[model samples]
Structures are given as structure tokens and as C-alpha cells.
Target: MSSVPQPPRWDVHRLPRARGRNFLVTGGNAGIGYFVAEQLAGTGATVVLGSRDRAKAEAAIGSIGSRVPGARVKHMPLDLADLDSLKASVDALGLDRLDAVVLNAGVALDRPPRRATGDGHELMFGTNHLGHFALTNHLAPLLTATPGSRIVTTGSFAAKSERLDLDDLQSTHDYRPKRAYARSKLAQMLFALELDRRLRAAGSTTLSVLVHPGGALDSLTPSRPPLHVRTTGERLSRLPLGLLVQGKDAAAWPAVQAVLDPSVHGGRMLSPRAFGLRGAPRIEPLWSHLADTTTAARLWTASRDLTGHDPTFTAPARSGGTEGPAAGPGEADASTG
Candidate 1:
């Protein structure tokens, strides 16, 4: 007789108290990012909501404050599609230390016309991979200074079905929306793995983790003003398929777990247990190709070349290190929203 399936060992819904800690969540204005921010703040962590639109950011902060009493939230305008905007926002934050950063912003729609960013790179690749690449490198020093800091890169199950063409990282010649998005997600996974290895090699305490929130429905997440407004159709549709497709709150569990769980270590991956669609977050083997070390290194090199940002950690001086924020050739700017 087949044995009954055991429940998840760790409770994904119930999070540990995180008072006095601080976190930054990209794309925190809506969907999974907003829910992740809420969850963190609900447990007493100060959350900074990063969004391109100030109104949306303030609205999200308000929503979080109303829902989670005593929630401390700040707004930092960030446009992931624009490098200069991201740098400016980071500078404005004036952060000396950060406990964790959740890189959750990206273009997920697999539509036609093959959009491109103002920087001339493919939209999906630029926003999902290069943008986060530059931002993380820019904040590496602050992250290194904070004990037990984590950099969680959000990936997707689609990475398993996508192929990365290192030669054409921008997808200049062959551009398909769905494939481009998949390749970008795959690049994110590779970057997370490589970053963990590099951080460890540098003897830094900061951890880099990879995670994916499988198939979450927007209908289930809170409706923020202006954006994330769930239409009647969406709410009605979710009524029948709620069990099959989990809400954004549940989907964000793995990312929040990656950040708060002390047991999670660098170079580890987390995702939903039930075939990546729904269930509690759990450690699982990466898709065979995404675990390729050689490819990860190559992606790292290519990212540095393209984004002009390096994550390599150097020893700080006894007095004060001279290493400053990374400065590279300016890329065209565009609104993430």
C-alpha cells in the first residue's frame, strides 16, 4: 500500500519574529513583491518598498501599514529597467547596512513585438537579469558589512525549459517574448549560484540564495491603489481555481524563507514542493542545466562585460576602504512601470 504523503516539516505560513531587522523588496508595489513586503513587515521588520512609481509605492506602504499594525515601511523609487535610476535610488537610500534584498522585479508577460529597453537590450533580459546584476553589485559592500545578510534572487520554473545562448545574451538576432523571459530567468538562477560561490570564496558572511514562487494568481493578492487592482473577472475566476493556483502571499513564502531562515545557506535553492505549482517551500534539486558551473561562470563574465558591474569582494582597509560604488557607462533610462 502506498504510504500517505507527509505534510511539510516547516510551516510556510507562520514566520519567525524579525524585530529590529530591515529588508528591501524590489517591485514591492504589487503582487508577490507587495505580499512579501507585507509579510516581512507584519513580523516587525522594517521594509523599504522599491518601485518606479512614487504614488504606487506610497499606496503600497499605506496598504501595508493599514493591514499590519505598526508596520514600518519606506519608499525608494527604483526603475529596474534603467541603470542610472537604480543607482540614483540606491544613493538616495543612504544605506550603511542591509539585512536582505529581495530581487523580485521582472517582465513576465510573454507577448509579441519583442520589446527592448532604452538601453537597447532585450526588455526581459535587461529588467530581469542586468538590472538586478548592477543593483546587487552596487550594494555589495553594505551587504558584506551586515552580519548574516542575504541576497535572494527570484527565479521561475520556466528556467527549466529555457536555453541560454551565451553568444547572444541580449537575444538580438532571435527574439521571442516567452523564450527571452525564460532565458533571463535562467540567467538569474545562474547568477545567484555564482554569487554564492564568490561570496564564500571572499570569506564574506553574506549569503546568496535562489528561489521561485510557483504559479501564483494575482486575484488572491491585496489590491493596491492605481495598480494591482483586481477586476471582477479575476476575482470571479479565482473562485473556482483557488486550490490549483496559489495566491501571491503563499507564492512569496520561499523568498521570505530564503531570507529569514538561518538554516538556509549560500548556494541553496528553494521552491514550492508540489511540482512548483503549490504547497510549502522546500529545498529541491535545481534543473539539471541550471546547475552547470561552467555556464554560471561564463554568465558572470558576460554580465560584468555587459552591465559594467563586478560583484567581486575585496578586503577592506583597517581604517576605511577606498572602494566606492561601481560606476559604468550610462545606459538609457526607462520607467519600469
Candidate 2:
């Protein structure tokens, strides 16, 4: 008889408590983000729901509170597609002591090429990579204050399918949705690994991890075709169908693990159990080929330069634009925001 297979041992619900810690979950209003925030708040952590919509953030906070009384969830406006908005939000609510940060707000802006976040970069790179890049850098002081702080950024299996185009990141020469998304994810890997190098070189112990959710419940999974095509595909996929992993909850698993897992080391990678696609979460090895020292260093330099930050490696970004405020009688600082 075929043995009953066991599932991966990780379940975010079974994770340890996060009491006394603070977290920021962007796009926390819905989908996997909702679960991530809910879980964090449920564990007694102070969570700030970052979103572009004030009303939506408020609703997310209410949802968290209703689900877990006195969950201590707060709302702040954060638009990943707009650096100005993120800068303002950081100034308004980004604290001096951040224990963890989740850079989850992303879009499949594969519809068309466009400038995003800030600095007139392409939409995919700007929103998926640069925006979070700025946010994390701006909040460096707060993160470092926590001593073993973790920075969690999302990656996708699409990296395997798409190659990097360093010369024209905006795809001015050759722009495809898949290529844009993959390059950004590749940047995510390079960014995380380089950060680890920088932290270790400076003798710092903070963890910067990258997690890919396989197929998860994310849009990365192509929707099935019509009934006839789907049926045939399903039958053919039987040899591998069981290995497919898909779902936001599943994707969130690896991310949650990377940040919360005590056993995880800096720069480590975690992914689903399926054949590079979807399932329960666990600590997997880094896609080691991504351990490109030259590439990592180069990407870091490019990112900092492109994002309007300085020192090519360390130091906070110089506020490039005129500062503004969220409401009456206040002005946001672009430098650290």
C-alpha cells in the first residue's frame, strides 16, 4: 500500500508568540496580507497596517480587533505605488523601534510599462522592489534598535522563468510583464544576500531573509483554461499535479517562518515543499546561484542610486523631493521617511 504522505511541519498558527514586539504589514487590508497581519496581531504584537487607503486600513484594523479583542492594530496610509505617500506614512507612523517589517505590497502591473513609486522607474521594479527598498532603508534606525530585527521581502518562482536585463531594467529595450516581475524578484534575492553580507561585514547580526511561496495562491499560477482544455491538462498534470503548491496562506507560511523562525540564520531562504511550486512551508536552502557577490553588490549600488539613496551601501537616503505632511500642521521628512 502507498504510505500516507505527511505534510510539512510548519503551520503559522503553531508558531511562537510575538508578545512585546512590533510589526508593520503593508497591504494588510486583504488576502495573504490580511492573514499575516491577523496572525501577528493575534500573537499580541503591535501591528501597524500600512496602506494607501485610510478607510481600507481602518477596516483592516477593525477586522483584526474584532477577531482578536484589543489586538492593538493601527492604521496608516502607505501607497507602495507612490514614494511620496510612503514617505509621508513613514514620517507619520514609522517608529524609532521596529522589530520586524513585511514588504508585501506588490502589483501585477504587467498591463503596461509605466513609472512607479518614485524616481520615474518602471512600474514593476519601482513598486515591487524600490519602494520597499526605500522603506526598509528609511526605517533602518528602528530596525537596528531591536538587535535581532528581521526584514522579510517576498520573492516568486518566476525568477526561474525570467532572466535579468541589467542594461534596461525598465525594459526600454525589451519589456515583458514576466521579465519585469522576475528581474525584481531577482533583485529581492540579491538585495537580501547583499544585506546579509553588509550586516556580517559590519559585525551586525540582524537577519534579512528572502522567501518564495512556490505557486501559492498568488496570481503567479496561471488560471486554468476552459473545461475541455483544463480537463486534459489536469489529467496530464497528474504526474506532477500533486506537487503544485498554490495559495496566499501557503505563500505567507514561508514568509512568516522566515521572520519568526528562531532557527533561521541571516540570508537564509525558505520555500514550499512541492517541486519548486506550492505546499506547506519549511526552511529550504537559498537558491544558491543567487549568491552572486558581484551581482549582489552591483544591484545594491544600482538600487541605492536609482532609489535616490546614498553612500552606495550604508547611510540613509537623502530626502530628494520637497517634504509634505499627511494632515494639518505637520510636515513629513523625506530623508528618513
Best by TM-score: 1
Relative to the unseen true structure, what is the C-alpha lDDT of residue 267 in candidate 2, on a scale of 0 to 100? Answer: 77
TM-score of each: 0.87, 0.78
Residue 309, model 1: lDDT of 86
Clashes within 3 Å, all models in order: 0, 7
Q: Write the per-residue lDDT of candidate 1 for residues 174-246, one digit (tens) a residue.
A: 8787888889999999999999989888877778999999888878655665556777878887877667668
TM-score of 1: 0.87
List ranges where model 2 is wrong by over 4 Å.
1-11, 113-118, 218-243, 310-337
What CA RMSD would you report for each candidate?
Answer: 8.6, 11.0
Cα error of candidate 2 at position 231, Å: 21
Per-residue lDDT of 1-337 in model 2, one digit per residue for the tens? Answer: 7999753444555656666678888777766676678777766678888887787677677766766766889887876667656566777885766777877777775556454545577777888777787787767767765666778877778886555667786667677777788888777777777887787776654678877767644343222221012244544555354456564555677777776666677777777877656766666766655867887787778888787763212322336653221111111211100
> What TM-score does model 2 achieve against the real structure?
0.78
Candidate 2: worst-modelled 10 consecutive residues by lDDT = 328-337
Candidate 2: pairs in clash: 51-78, 215-277, 216-246, 216-247, 217-246, 217-247, 245-278
Q: What is the lDDT of residue 127 in candidate 1?
A: 93
